[model samples]
Target: MDKMQRMEQLVEQLNQYNYHYYTLDQPLVSDKEYDLLYDELTALEAETGITLPDSPTGRVGGELLQGFKPHRHLAPLWSLDKAQNEEQLINWNNRVLRLIADYNSKNPDTPLPDPTYVVELKFDGLTLNLTYTDGKLVQASTRGNGVIGEGILAQVKTIKSVPLTIPFTAGTIEVQGEGIMNLSVLAKYNETAAEPLKNARNAAAGALRNLNPRTTAERKLNAYFYNVGYSDGIRFSSHQEMVAFLKENRFKVNPHVTYHDSFQEVIDVLHTIVDKRSSLDYLIDGAVIKITDMRTREVLGYTDKFPRWAVAFKFEAEETTTVLESVTWNVGRTGKITPLARVEPVELAGVTVQNCTLNNVGDIERKNLKFALGTRVFIRRSNDVIPEILGKVTEEQDGGEIVYPVNCPACGFPLEQRGAHLFCNNRLDCKPQIVSRITHFASRDAMDIETFSEKTAEQLHDELNVREPAELYTLTFEQLIKLERFGEKKANNLLKAIEESKGRDLASFLYALGIPNTGKSTTKVLADHFRDLDKIMNATVEELTELPDIGGIVAESIVSFFADPFMQAGIHKMLSLGVEAKPPQQAAPVTDSFFSGKTVVLTGTLHQLGRDEATARLEALGAKVTGSVSKKTDLVIAGEKAGSKLAKAQELGIPVIEDEDELIKLLNGQNE
Candidate 1:
């Protein structure tokens, strides 16, 4: 046979081998034999400069793709209501019952049958929506918004388990599933990876979202389809039927789906799943409970956000025990010493965690870990955040004592106890404190000096003697060029960047000051309220506390930060060096605008306008633009690819302006 014919034969053979091995978990051939055949096909394809459409080489990934195009889903990918506890689960069931009762009461002749539930593992990974036409996988996308998603067909094709073609010659269908990196796969990848991934969920999601399909293939992702969201000429009486359909079509459907005739039985199954959660190879954050009967699901219908017949029973954050091997104290920019606990590496939430935060020395004492080093401690990680030590596993104080340092770890300065924290008052002499302060001042949200990094900060502190933010303004190109790795171009670039940072806005300047217990939001509020540096520096704690989101502690921190003689000297020096803390331009008071008195939230990427500009415009119209969505939020302006914030807005029934045109119109006070 010719090369083309042989390539076709090999492609079909390799596809079957992949299906048997990856989907059915049964290898058809030895790895050596498979590789030989694959290599032959690869060589032939390269020789001819042509590859067939169904070639197995596609699974190896192709060239990089341009940015993802928005794929409008045929059917909306609905979010599920969550039940964090048994009480919440029971409440959800009651709501379903009430809805079903009301529906059956209206239709007496053909009343819906009593609800039965289907429980499936809720994989904690990226949501994938795949579209097929004429048995060919045409498109794959992320669950961006319920209505639209970013098309990622090349990334999805890299998954060996995702069938390129199916036996079902349907007109069109959209299948919904989760793309996940198995915990085992993640661990294996980390062994050889230069930069190890932190978590399987993030690894899978980041891979799929990567512009290069080669990166996605490197992750070796697996998918499990659960729901047939859209079908042209297909129907299922129950979710079980849908799963069977997915399985029949060679889609990898998870095998953990269970059916129960009663809600109480479903709850029992959930508890059983929770007990076995740690044993699973993949990450499952919860169990999804859906009404089994499709007709009943139709009768129950959906809320604005989620289906009334379905709820996700979310498991509590994973907790595991590990030995608290030792504790190391580190100094921050504010000179506060934080105790970091080194523990025996343990897997929690698909990540091997060896270090956990103890917050401060007081946290160590309060958690009874003062004498618990070398003993097992309970560490809980929630929402993929850094793990925290809950307490020791046992009441016995048999482990080694955790000694608190009397001096700063970095500078050997005498420490002072303030509240629960230890502080080093050495601002000028401490290397870590100075370096961190310089880094923070040049951070993107602050002065935004391009190419500035922690290493650069360290080099400046050690070599240039640039101990403070104001000192940065004094460095000449001649002095900078003498430093290690500093060429003439590099020195000039650094000087230019420093020159540009002198024009940073007042809010950014305030944040760069690194006030203790204060954040960017508070700084922005201060800049907006005071609009002048001298006014803010002289403002009393009572005046500061009158601002929104400013508590007594924050007020005191601001007041105290300005009160320091060193801080006063720094500000004066910065001003003398021509640093312009330019106040925002004043706008006319807007009391009668549509956004006036409204609590608004902006999320996702705005193609037409920048996020900061949108915020400024909203604020100028008297709108209180917050970072998160809540019941108090009167409106949400969601741009393209809006995620959880948009979902929350929908769940809370807060009105959302999704289109850029509509947002612009609203901003201009024009009628819809």
Candidate 2:
């Protein structure tokens, strides 16, 4: 067949596979067959020189949006004043007392009201706004820049914990919540995950902001809506009453909350949370204490950005004794050498944490976290956020203090101190740096060359006499099968993943290129501006840094990638394999702000405007149409309920729009 026909067939097959994998959770073909087809299609696309819109190549979407258009917050989401340490927390206690004294002065005859503080676990997850009307859930948004949040109302409903339709009958209420995933699911996800996740908080935060809602759902995420963002026609005089109302409305409110008559009681609860922090399913970084009485809260009101009624009391990180088996170092993309402690497996939080970050040699000195072989050290994983060594030796553990390494642990090169960081200038040749770089190249956000997993990568390097990402394509199906643990099926699947990765849109490839600070978002902007991979490869530092998000480091990385004859050589090999990359066609600058306040939902197959076109248009305007309808949605544009979002939108009272023309007119600054 001609390259065009070949390309066309591959698109049809790959699109179907993507729908099955991404949309249906079922893949039809075996790993090897899919890879061959994917590889063929990528070759055809490169040979024919045409970019497809629905191509899986376009993941992460195009472009880091030129500085987000600011949307006026319905109710300004104020920042909370932080108590970084115990001293600040005590000052907060003193301030709460003064406020109560001032309140008593006005009603001298009445006994001084025993003011109460409600304490709740401060979850280490993404904060969101959920809007409800007449007890139906409508909209959900991220606290993007505090003033305007990304309207992810569609993604929000996919989360089963977030009620699409409220159980209680209330006019209008804004529910505040923390979107989090438990550690059990996190571990399970990491088992099948593209890579081992850093921590639960990063995983949870990444899940909420993900482009695909299906990903959000599969993670088994849940949330606890604690604060009343705003509720109309609801008469809740106290914080306790509001929380009770939330519970009555079938909302998942934090059950740990208790009303305290004094700061001492609040402190007691804080201590209790710190003690119990290691056992909770969800990570609690701190305790959020708020005034219980609404009238008292109003009296305290707010500062320029924070409410005076509430404060977050972050506890000192919980530390426990663990015997350090050894210390290892990892070289990062930024060249910072990070020290890790291999500890005796201990169940500190909900799971057994094995490795703890020592940060750097300076950190070792500062925390006295020095550890020699077999040294007993105080290990702390703060709220299951990140593990750290509290201290190493002396009377504390009767362990020997470890001497910090003065040379690069990997290459044994003399390390130079730059500020707080220690660096190994060996760059890409270093083993950790090479593995990390190659791994990054095959990442989901990057070139997405899935076949090069850690096992396959290790096998290829240590066993198959192969090294680096470029060597991946040269891997024969038989070679993959020959590796230990590699059955015919697993080998075929890995090959398919590699084939599918070829001919990705330039955005993904750039991200995969492992440029410093230049990942998914940065890749899109560069792809559009450069319009070709060769131009980007040849770009000067001055030329690269000109893009919005691409700063000095990123630009330097780009310049370095091309300069590294090694990286350039890899790109050439990839191109020779028909793993071509190209820029997307730039759409016209939109003038209509129709999307300004509208919440739109697109369904079924659109003709005039493809899914990508429709989404981009709506986003350019001021409209905040989400993927699903909740209490906050104004309308739904249904072509056909291709996805689950359509059914949920209908179950709610969202006004459904029919086609692109209707959406266009509505967005063209027209009411009709």
Candidate 3:
């Protein structure tokens, strides 16, 4: 075949392998083989006239910029008034309620629902704005001191969660989301470092500010959008309800959001979260307390800064404003595009600052920011990694209105919207999508086919027409002999890696699918509960939701997945290639016990084992766990300062037991 034909064939195959590995979780090739193929393709592309926009050659290593310039915003990115303690919170709550009461009392014609509040776990991370013009992602910016910040268009692209384009057919849309670290990123990064990370939030801020896009990818940072920035005539009644709308538009949102009828309900929700905060996966520094009515926010209006209708009660200092320099974009494992912001290096508490997250195209409109144009912006860097643009308008200046992209930079596809997201539909031909997917599929967690690397996949797919992972097992030594750096033994090793991936756990397979909302924990829950993929696919949303830890979102994703033709076809194809998932071994059914329906609270200290172990044992014994001491507690197992728990148990007059000795004996008794 001619050189042009060969190059086209190679690019297509590499991207397919990337998609399966990166986005979907299944990898079919060995790194060595993939690399050899990619190297050959690169050489050919250089020698021949054929060029592909999605070529693996483009995603090579690059250096960080010398420095960043800031863009001043049109509006000042003002800081919020914070409530630190219960008294402050109560005082604020009283004032808000009194305002509504007075407003309603004066205007007897209109009755209100007591002006309820929506309480959400204030994510301890950076804030961001993604501007979408004509429903396409264009530019991202930091909330410069609430006025101006740096521009990080290229750096923003590194974050996969931030969409490069909006999926809507409308002329414009903006989104707002919190850019934060993944659940376990810090722990993993710190495990090998000289000084392990102190917390996840810090790691997130540092990661987003990183100049290296590849490093940003490795951190696995994530973002969830919650508000609409600027839309032409977009309609929504309440901010709480808008969350649902954003999700419909394909934006990520906080899972712990709730509405309340009274301040007590709001307090109850807030306290409940604080009590069980440790159990939450993502880091949270405070609670975002807001009025449920949009009109109320407008009526309350803003002072020089902050919305009078809303207050952020910070729990622990996780998010603090810094300065921004720029924003960049990246196409993730899926065809979806993401945005990140780059900022001028500044110190928040201790760590140096630079960039944070703008989140996606929707953010730009919501934040209503101009380019940094060389000004300081307020960036909240959590724990020193995931930095997000929040406030920065120190002074007002005019920059051109930020616009979103209309076409995919990778495949040039018009973006398609799904709920709160914008996804590129040219998956079949998109180069970046394919490469990213392949990288993920071949990752150690998926297939454990360690021989495959992004470089290798690029080579094999683009140079050799190896479209799918399964094709890796089909390569011949004769093909290797024709490549640029031919060596038969290396080719053999690549073949060996493919052979080893045939038998992997069902959990890994599910994770590899790159199904939306399906992370490692959810994968384990679904796999362990169902025991097989067929059952998971056929199960109704209700059935899936019934499983503990398997939430409604995950169930919906599984259902929606089975509803797709291409995924089903891919599944059958994979199954035909001898790809199989092994179910986890389970223990024999244990005897019924008295703790079956009881809830237990273990506070302060436990002498027998750590908290996780104790919780595990309690769960194994069929007992539910509550973080706080309560009247409904069947028994309170207190150890030492168990302070509040001990006092609360006494107040309720519930029987309080101490130590594992008595608890074990009580369990043996089986009832009384």
Candidate 4:
């Protein structure tokens, strides 16, 4: 046979060998034997000065690209709603039941069947959408914004398990999978690299996104296909069928793909996966739960953000260790000093974390971090909050001591010990404290000043000699116009906002005052109960504590705040400058409403009602709206994409009202 014909034969045989070895993890030929054939194919391709598109030799690294071109996906990639715990998973199942039942009710003649589910690992890696026409791989792209993605076909071709050609030569189709660096591969690569990679996920993602395909090839990435996003001449009745098609096409399918007729069985599999996660060779932050029935998925349909038929169960907070380099103290508007620990930058949960909250000096002492400077410490990040230093790696203090400050770092004022916290009493003179106070007073919850920001407050403080909330009312348009970035329109707008804030009701004014230990809820309660600011100011600690949700600490805070001469003078000055602090007019109690006397919680996105509007309506009807699910909750109004709280409510067996129409009817007194 000629070289070209021989190359063709060798390519087909080698591709089959590759499929068995990489995709199937069952090698049909020894490494030495495969290399001989590969060498011959390479030599023949060089001799002919040509390479076939489907040749096994195409897997080699190629020349660098100038830039990535945009490729719009044939079908939009959808994001799944997430569940953090089993309670949330249960809630998702409940939502599925309701949607299926509602659809079945509408179409009695062609009712949908009870839903089965498929669970697969949510791999921590870059998402790849590969397009094929006539069973030949034609395009590959990232999941950028879901609709359009950066084309990386050259880079994707480097993945050994990815099939360049499939047996089915039908119309065009798009297959979705995750491009991941196996943990073992990452470790092996790091052993000899000049610059070691911090995590497998970033290594895979960076390699795939690199301009040079040769860099991607060196990563030795693997891919696991689990979805057929678009197909012109094919369709699947279930997720199991789609995965089977992927495997049949020689696409690498994860072994953990599980199907169950029962949701309980699905949960069991998830628990097992979590337990076996550390033993796996790749990184997975969570597991995805998808309904198996295509008809059921169609019935459930999509929210603007995610499909109602699927949800991701995320694992707990990720933890990592880094050196505690130093700690910096910051003073807040409340005069409390907080310790901010600066640590050696470490990759955790897909981001670099260099700073962690130490909370206070007492937290440092309790965690034995008082002498943790320059020592390794455990840090944890959860729910997207700032990372926190959990504790030192060991009890032994092998590093220098974390010296406590005797004076405020922001203003150098003498500090006072207040239980577990240290306080700086120079509230009026301290630059940080005064700037923060002014900023808080003009915040959205407080005065609702338009275009007002912390930087604006700082400028006003430094350039215009403005300090305290009352001083904001005294500013002139002429004064503001002279400041940097302040034009005539901006100055007038600021003045207008300041003037409009004078008519704000008592609750907002109270919250703007920045009373220690009191939040917006407490201020609202104080306003609603007392009606007048003077009454609240004169209220004894006993009287303040009598109200619901007001504990001793809150009552003491309110009493101590109003008792201060400086605070009293500030309130008086604001009133003198036309600040109304208007009391709300009394209305009859909502004693005979459907939601009256009930404790309710709201979760998820409501298409018909904004969360704030829903909360206002619930409060108007005498419902005590809360932020969490608990035994005390009488009802839970779950909207689209409801997650953990919805699950917690279901777990606690609380009554749930998911129908927007029903909620609107009840809210309108039609149901009552």
Off by over 4 Å in 3: 1-63, 72-77, 105-113, 193-199, 316-672
Model 2 reaches what TM-score against the true structure? 0.44
Each prediction's total of clashing residue pairs, residues at least 3 apart in sequence or on different chains, is 0, 19, 140, 0
TM-scores, in order shown?
0.54, 0.44, 0.44, 0.54
Q: Per-residue lDDT tens digits of candidate 2, residues 215-322?
A: 666666767788777766776788888888776665666556777777778787787667555545567778888888887777778888889888988765455677
Task: Kindly report the root-mean-square deviation of model 3 from the true structure over all alpha carbons.
Answer: 23.8
Task: Compute the lDDT of residue 231 as modeled in candidate 3.
Answer: 70
Compose the digit string of candidate 4's lDDT tens values, residues 371-487. Answer: 889999888664356898867778787888988899989889999998879999997889888999999999888888888999999999899878788999889988888899999
Kindly list the per-residue Cα lDDT of model 3 for residues 1-672, writing each as its tens digit. 988888878887776665444333345687788888898898997787565654555444236766556755433555778998778888987887787787788877874556778887777767666666775566556655766666554455555445443457576665656777755555466445543343466566665566665665556666767767667647677876787767565555665678888888877777766654544456777788888888777667677778788888877543454445455666666767766777667666456656576766655433444555455555554432466665445535454334456678777889876653567877667777777666676677777776678887778768886665545656777886676665777777766776777788888888777777776556767887889999987889999888655568878988998878877877777788778878866655344875666767777667766565665566677776655554457777775445556545543455677666777665665446
Error of 2 at 611 (Å): 16
Query: Which window of ten consecutive residues has the lowest lDDT sum in model 3?
Result: 18-27
Per-model lDDT: 0.87, 0.68, 0.66, 0.87
Q: Could you tell me how far off, in angstroms, the CA of residue 615 lies in candidate 4 after the best superposition?
A: 2.0
lDDT string, candidate 1, 360-462, tens digits: 8766766677899899988867444578887787877899999999999998999999877999999899998999999999999899999899999999988
Model 3 global lDDT (CA atoms, 0 to 1) = 0.66
Q: Give the higher-TM-score candidate: 1 or 2.
A: 1
